[model samples]
Target: MINIQLLNKDFESRVRLGIMSILMVRDWVEFKELKELLDITDGNLASHAGALEKNQYLQVRKEFVGKKPRTTYAVTQLGRKSFQDHLAALEKLLGQP
Candidate 1:
């Protein structure tokens, strides 16, 4: 029997899932890049990122490149483990082992 409870509520949102998915492979991704890749508005990304940040699943860095302000995001150690576990649960639900 598949345990739906094993799935993480924090990653329920597709936006959040996409964010974490991108962060999983990349060391860091800029706000603009993330928005572009996700095909979401700035406010949409900000809201979703804020939720992930609140969960301690992600780290945000803000800095300036010369005169330009820049923001980047990365997944934390806890996030990696949590996301991996979530994937495992999903796989089990799919009967993939």
Candidate 2:
């Protein structure tokens, strides 16, 4: 039997899932790029990213390029492992392995 508890609460939201999914492939992504890719508003992205940050699952970097401010995000090592475990649980739940 599958254990529902294996699923991570931190990634319950599709937004968070998307964020991690993107970061899993790319080294880093800027805030605006993530917003556009996820088709979400600034506030929406910020809130979700904030949650992941609080959980230590993501890294947020803020800096300026010339006069423009830039925010970027990447998955932490803990996040990578957690997300992988979550995916494995999902696959097991689906009877894929």
Candidate 3:
């Protein structure tokens, strides 16, 4: 219901929110780790990640983990700032500020 104005046109999905919420507390997260955390199917996870990636809210690096391809995502400095702003705005909207 437009809970927040959004930091970007993107970064607005519930899945993206979940991913950003978790990443806010960590250095980086693996693709599978995010999928598990959000309890999302592979396709869902990839799509949301793709949106965030396109908006430059995340930095994704694909590599090999034990001969298997692995994707890792990290919040960029801009992303950290944006997330903070987004949270603060949400709080304000909820009359918490």
Per-residue CA lDDT of model 3 for 42-76, tens digit only, reads 99999998887877789999999798999999988
Off by over 4 Å in 1: none
* Segments of candidate 2 deviating more than 4 angstroms: none
Q: Which 10 consecutive residues of model 2 have the lowest summed lDDT?
A: 88-97
Task: Rate residue 12 of model 2 by lDDT.
Answer: 88
Q: Which ranges of candidate 3 are over 4 A from the true structure?
A: 1-9
TM-score of decoy 3: 0.85
Error of 1 at 23 (Å): 0.5
* Candidate closer to the true structure by lDDT (higher is better), 1 or 3: 1
Q: Where is the poorest 10-residue window by lDDT in model 1?
A: 88-97
Q: Which candidate order results from sorting by TM-score in descending order?
A: 2, 1, 3
Expressed as tens digits, the lDDT of each residue in 1-97 for candidate 2 is 6689999988989999999999999999999999999999999999999999999999999999999999999999999999999998888889944
